[model samples]
Target: MDFDYDLFVIGGGSGGVRAARLTAQDGHKVALAEESRMGGTCVIRGCVPKKLMVFASEYPEAIGYARDYGWDAKVGDFDWSAFSGHMRSELDRLEGIYETNAQKAGVKIYHGRATVEDAHTVKLGNGQTRTAKHILIAAGGHPVRPDMKGGDLGMVSDDVFNLEALPRKLLIVGGGYIGCEMAGIFNGLGVETSMMIRGAQILRGFDEEARGHIADCMGRRGVTIHTGCAPVEIEKRGDRIWVKGSSGHQDEFDDILWATGRKPNTQGLIAEGVGVKLDRRGAICVDDYSRTDVPSIHAIGDVTGRVELTPVAIREGIAFHETVFRGNKTPVDHELIPTAVFTQPEMGTVGLSEEAACEQEPTLVYATAFRPMQQAFAGGEERVLFKMLVSKETDRVLGVHIVGPGAGEMIQFVGVALKMGATKADFDRTCAVHPTMAEELVTMKEPVRVLD
Candidate 1:
């Protein structure tokens, strides 16, 4: 059967762009359609801009540390205008790169929404339809506000980067990574920041000890965390946004942010008769190879609700190319993925949490927490943690969790060892890097607890 193109991609995100470009480079007639920015969520409104804000927020703390190091470091008020302007420019540059790279690889780029009309047919918003031998859906997810009174008044994670001015007082709702990271960013920018989450602790799915440590550190740093609380009602009162929590707590803030959850961006994407299936969460149903129920249609990235991380989506894209285009049948490996949360005191973790590891088998836990040399010498109260969960039967590391500065960077290297099935003995025999916080990973001699 003849088709308008060999492949049609429905998103321009990291995953879609990757698959389109690589497949097009292999001499396939590939075209991509994106309704929004070319770089989609991660490059435009999500990771790139958020991480830049995280970097900007850290400068004031660094200035404080410099004063203790005998350097005259006087910090001034954060200039959100200056930083946001630069951030937007960086996003523009990145978006251009995404489009340019795809074009260079001979993939046609269409700037409009593309919906599946059939397994091989895609209809653009401009009233044109294109047919392809294979269709790829990589549309990412969007931050969703909870259903509540005056929820429209609350901003979302996407709206944070575009705020004209930082609020004097900000109330953040939710306890996930998005909410905690935003709380830190706003607090460091000199806003009176408060967070409300229904969970007993923030980062509910993480290691309990690590979550408590982060909550404690955030509280000590002046971010008021209202756990066991959630907004039941929100309204505007005079110049402030008033929120009434389920815990009977009431507060007024200059702005309210809703980071409660996210949903797949799949509305109106699949035609009614296309026979594409979606899961209970509205995520596209895809198999291990990212193939949809329909033979020629596939989905990846946040839309598939698998891992929900940018790099994982890229890997899925690569695997899709290997399977479909190269006949290699590569399935995505979702195990032992290392991830970092960019809070003030960051958290890096890979593999299972201690709670999860123990449930699977008898586990040994080793953990240490102390103020590192830099913070200790600077007279700071911030502490760092190095923890490992090991399988007692197999003698292999099941998990590695670190909470401190540069924890993210350290975890990437540690993730390599864990992915290679490195045992606890492999770490113990390795020479410790002298006078380093990470050396604690190797130097822990005994398990603090043995769980059966």
Candidate 2:
């Protein structure tokens, strides 16, 4: 059957863009439709902008540390207007690059909302329909406000980058990475920040000890963290937002931000009409090869709810092209992916957490917590943690977790080692770099605990 194009991508996120570009580069006719900005969540709203904010917030702390090093240093008030203007400008540049790259690869770009009319047809917002031999869905997710009274009074993570002015006092809800990281960013920027979590601790499902250290450090750094409580109601009182907590405590803040969670963006795409299967969470159900129930349709990235990281999405797209176009079967490997949380103290972890490792095997934990030489000499109360989980029977490093400065950068290198099946002996034999926080990873000797 003749079609308008060989492939039609319904979203222009990292996953969709890569797939479209690669398929087009393979000499297939391809077109991509994006209703919003080309860069999607990571570049425009999620990781890129958020990390920039994190870097901006860290300057004040660095200035303070400078004073201890015998330099006369003082912190100036953060200028939100100036910083936000530059941030938006940078995002615009990145979005243009994404569009230009896709165009260079010979993929036609359509800037409008698109919905599936059938397994092989996509209808754009401007009253035009395009037919293709195959269709790909990679529309990402959006942060969702919790269902509660006066929920509209609160904002989500997306609204953070667009605030007219930084709040003098901010109340953040949830205990996940988004919530914790935002709390740190705002607190460092001189906002009186507070957070409420339903769970007993922040960063649930992570390395418990690492998260505990971060929570403690954040509290010491002036974030009013309330665990085992959530907002029951939010009310607007003049310019301030009043929140009633589950613990019966009430407070008022200049703004309330909800970092509760995100939902798959499968709503308006008409997946149901095309007989595509959706999971309970609204994510598209796909096979190992990213093919949906309809052979002509496929889904990847956050929309599929499988390892919703940006890099993972790109890998999935590569695998899809290999299987369908290059005639080589490829499946995305989701195991042992390293992740970092940009909290003030920071956290980088890979492989498995001690809690998760113990559930699977007899695990031995080697852990250390101490004031690093720099912080100790500078007379700061800050300390760093280095921990490794090893399989008792095999002497293989089951996990590596670090909480300190440069943890994110450290985990990226450690992730490679773990991926290569590096064991405890491999780490023990490697020489350590002197006068560094990361040296602790290879220096810890005895097992702190053994869980049978």
Candidate 3:
């Protein structure tokens, strides 16, 4: 019953690469196929380069505030071409690292798209096939482009990173995290930016107050926010790209970026070839154990359309190996995962939203908001937003949401506490860290409103 390899992974994303590494370390012969770059979407076009631009944009804004904090500021110029050149260099460095890691772990990395030929075999675009005892689909997701007139005049998520120079004014289509982050980056770097989302608010799933605050803060920071609007068509005249959407809303910009949404990268892979199932949204179907209808085949990450996050992908990839290959049983709780949005001010949240908790049970909602010390020092009007939802009956902390500085850095540990089923009392009993904004979590007064 020996196979050509123990595992054959398609897609070298966080999930696929992680699976290849871990399973190989576990002494499983593994070969992974990546149609594009070694690092997949997150490393190539999405998170890595996007975040580097976020840092570059924020530094200029930070420099302006340094003088108010009694620090002398040295005049500096940021050349977009030069900065982008370095970013590309770092990306190439990461790509090499991924190759080195795969090679070190004894993974046969194939630089071609893969298709599932059967339950235990995958055929590559390069006309080679590999047989494995187990197969994992971690192709990840990509930005979805809408069909409309002149839509090609604008760019989508992938094209944004390829820009040789910054645009003067940016009109962003779709108000998801991608749109919001792009808007924030351009605005921070002194570009006139406007955001348009089909939803009523920017982030539709989070706490209503937090969503409202995000919109208000964006306005307060000079980025235009337009909600409940859908783009009808795109037009170009001279150097300006003009977008006309539903309700006759017309906006023009030097550059247009559409962050509308992402589709699971499962357009192919021969799901039906082996009787694997897919959800209505075109995502590979998987259970809590990530096993598809076909027992030997499995799926994870955005392809599964479960929780579309990088960490989730990696964790699931590793957990999958533990359950199947290593004869150990471990699972990732799909709920209450911590995540961050890297916009102008940044936002972090863990666990359920107040809206979600209240829906489960009319619960207690205790919230606090303020201006951080940095904003105070810089005389900026942006405010920090923090809130927690707790179950009135069980006293369990149901959710934690924050919009402000260090939101990502602060929510991670809280996420761990939540996964352990820590109660509100546990948070309160925990000693507060002084001279820190995070301390506010432990020091908040009693519940603002406890729903019976």
Candidate 4:
């Protein structure tokens, strides 16, 4: 069938943009429609901006460390106006790069919402219908507020990047990574930050010991954590937002932020007759190759609810191009992905948690927690943890989890070793980098406990 374009991408996110650009570069006519920013969540409202904020928030403590090291450094009052202005400029620059690169690759860009009219047709926001030989949906997810009264009075994670001023007292809801990270960020910025976690512990799926250590560290640093508590109601009085928790805790704050969770963008995406299957969470149900039920349509990224990470989305996009354009039949892989949570005492983990690995077979847990040399020398009480979950039967390291400085960067390297199926003996045979916290990984001689 003759079509207006060879491919129509319904999002301009990392996945859709890469797929559209690559397909267009391969001499196929491609059209990409985005309702919002070109760089999607990661580049615009998410990782980029959030990481910058994390960096910005760390300076006050860093100044204290510098003073401790005899540098006489001191932190001044944080100017929200100047910092937010710079963040805005940086985001604008990144958005321009996304659009320019796509254009350079010969992909036609549409700055409006696009919906599936059928398996091979897309209707834009202006009611203009365009038919394509294939359609790609990479529409990303959005942060959701709690479905409770006065929930609209609170802000989502997206609203954090645009705050005109930082609140003196901030109440954050949710126990996940987003909520914890923000708690650290705001607390570091000298805000009176408190977290209300409905779950028994923050970072519910992580290693239990690591979760406890992080919660303790955040608490020690002055972030109040209300665990096993959830907001039953929210009320506004004068300039204060009051929240009543299920645990009979009530507090008033200058602002309340909701970091509960995110949901996929699937509403109005697939037409009534299009027969695209969506899972219970409204995420597109696609096969290993990202192909939907209809042959001419596919979905990737957060919309598919598969490993909702930016790099994973880009990898899926490349896999899609390899399978469709290069005849390579590449299937997306989601195993052993390393992730980092940017809390004050950060966490980087790959592979299964100790609890998860023990369920399958005998496992040996090697772990250590101590005050690192840097912090110890400066009379700081900050502690770091290094843990490894090893399979007793196969002698392979099943998981590696680190909670400390540069854990994220360390996990990336450790992830490569884990991916190559490195065993405990392999780590033991390696020499430790002296005076480094990561040396603990190679030096832990015995299992703290054996789970059979």
Candidate 5:
């Protein structure tokens, strides 16, 4: 059947943009509808802006280290106005780039909400209906705020980037990566930051040792972390917000930020009405190739609730293009993905955690925790950890986890080795770069413990 376009993509996130651009580049007609900005969460409100804040927050520590190194360095008051203005400008430029690139690739841009009318039809908010041979949904997700009394007075991660001024006292809720990262950023920016975790520990899904080290570092850095507790009620009194914790504690703060979690963006798309299967979390259920239950429809990125990372979404989009356009029948490989949490010290990990490794089979753990030369020389008490998990029988490195500076960059290279199935002997055979923290990866010859 003849349609208005070959592809009609709902949402302009990383995955949606990539799919539209590439499919159009292949000479197929495409139209993309985005209710909001072009760059979606990662480029606009998420990774880019958040990472910039993380960099901004690290300056005070850098100044301290500079002073310790005998360089005359002092940190002045942070200028929130200047930084936020510049950040908005940067975001605008990035959004323009996304739009320009999509236009250059000959994809039609509809700047309004789009809903699925059927497997091959979409109705935009502007009272226009467009039909396509295929439809791709990449609507992404949004941060969730708890449904409680006076919760509307609190802010979410998105709201943090738009704050007019940094609060003198900030209360961050949730124990996930977002909460931990924001706590670190606010604390470093000289805000009296306190984190309320409903669970016993933060970063619940991460490696236990790495999460514990991060919690300790955050606490040492002056973040009042309250674990196994949560705010039962929030009250706003003029400029101050008061929180009553489940553990019978109460406090007032200038800001209350909820980093609780995010939910899939499938509200008005009507995927289920058009025979698309949705999981319990409202994420569209798709096969390995990102094809939805309906043959003419597909979904990717956070909307699919599979590997909710930007890079993963891009990869899935590329795979979808290959399978549909290039006749390559490619499926996204979502295994052994290396991830990093940008807390104060940072945590980078790949493959299995120690718990997962031991649960599977006999495992040998090689681990070390000590003060690194740089911090030690600076007369700082901060320490770093590097750990490796290896299978006793296969001798293959099962996992590598690091909690320290440069852990993120280090894990990127380590991820390549793990992806190539490098064994413990392979790491041992590699020569050590002397006096570097990463050298321990190659030099740790003896197992700290072997799990039977």
Candidate 6:
């Protein structure tokens, strides 16, 4: 059928942009609609800006290393307001880049929300119905605050980016990555930070070693972690917030951040008109190659909830082009995906946890622990832990986990190898680079791996 555009993308985030650009390159007209900025959550309010804060938070945490090495250095105090202002400027700069790239790729950018009017038609907020051969939903996700009264209890991850200033005392009300990250951030910046996770540990879905190392390190830095606790209410009490919780514990703080989690941003998409299937969390259900149940309609990124990370969205979008519009027709397998959590000490991991791997194969465990080379020079009592999970009989590495510096960077290649069924032998045969955190992955002796 002749259409206004070959593809109509209902998001301008990483996934939406990728789909629009690559599909456009495939000799098909593509138009993408975004209600706000060109960049989705990551470029706008998500990974990029958030990680910049994490990076800024790390400087203070790592500065102690210089002093520990007898470099008589006293890092000056951090100005929370200054960090906020700098981040705003950086985000502004990034917003423009996202806009220009889309234009250069010959993808029509619609600066308004899009609603699915039918299988091939999207009605933009500007009251125009654009029809296409295919429709892609990459609307992304939004932060959901905790159920509380006085809604002023706290702000979500999105609000943190727009902070007028950082609070000296932070009360993080969730145990997800955002909570773990911000808890580390404020505490590292010399603020008195407290974290309240309903479970025993923060970062529930991540590998245990990653959570363990972050929890231990954050504790060492004096961030009070309240586990097995859930906040019941949060209200301002003069200069502080009185937070009451399910555990009957009460705390007071100047700042409160509710990083409970995020929900799919589909409230006004009119998805029903196109018969798109969404799960209970509001995520569109997609098949192996990111196609929705309805053939002409597809979804990716946080909107799909298959993989919530930024890189995953980008990969899915790129793969959509390869698998659908392009001749390659490649499918995406989400297994062995490398990920990182930038908490106190930082962590990176790729593949299943030992427990999950063992569940698949009863006796698969590969665990290792040692101090990093930097720790040797930093003269600090810090030890980096590493773990791997592999099929005992097959010896095929199933997972690789790292907790230390450069974790996020090191795990990318590990993820590639693990995805290709790399065995412990492959890791062993690789020569180690001297004096690097990644060298530990190759040098560690594989003893009997233990399950979590």
Clashes of each: 0, 0, 1, 0, 0, 1
lDDT of 5 at 5: 97
Worst 10 residues of 6 by lDDT: 443-452
Query: How much is 55 displaced in model 4, in angstroms?
Result: 0.4
TM-score of each: 0.99, 0.98, 0.96, 0.99, 0.98, 0.95
Ten-residue segment with the worst summed lDDT in candidate 1? Answer: 145-154
Query: What residue runs in model 3 are displaced by over 4 Å at the alpha carbon?
Result: 74-77
Model 6 segments beyond 4 Å from truth?
Answer: 70-72, 448-452
Task: Give the per-residue lDDT digits (tens) of candidate 4, residues 245-299.
Answer: 9999999999999999999999878889898999999999999999999998989
lDDT on C-alpha atoms for all candidate structures: 0.94, 0.92, 0.86, 0.94, 0.92, 0.82
Weakest ten-residue segment in model 2 by summed lDDT? 266-275
Clashes of 4: 0
lDDT of 5 by residue, 134-197 (tens): 8999999999988889889889998888899889999999989899999989998999999899
Assess the local accuracy of residue 180 in candidate 2 as a C-alpha lDDT between 0 and 100. 94
Per-residue alpha-carbon lDDT of candidate 3 for residues 1-452, written as tens digits (9 for 90 to 100): 77999899999988889989999997889999999898888898988999999998888768878888878994486688898889999999999999899889999988889999999989989778789999999898888777777777778989878888888898888777888888888887778888888888887787788878888888888898777777787777787887786867897789888787888887876846579988788899988889999999999888998888889898899889889888888785678789999977888999888778877987888888887887787887778888989888898888998888889998998899988999889998999988788988998877777765
TM-score (C-alpha) between model 2 and the true structure: 0.98
Provide the global lDDT of candidate 1 against the true structure. Answer: 0.94
> In candidate 4, which residue pairs clash?
none
Task: List where candidate 1 sits over 4 angstroms from the true fold.
Answer: none
Stretches of candidate 5 off by over 4 Å are none
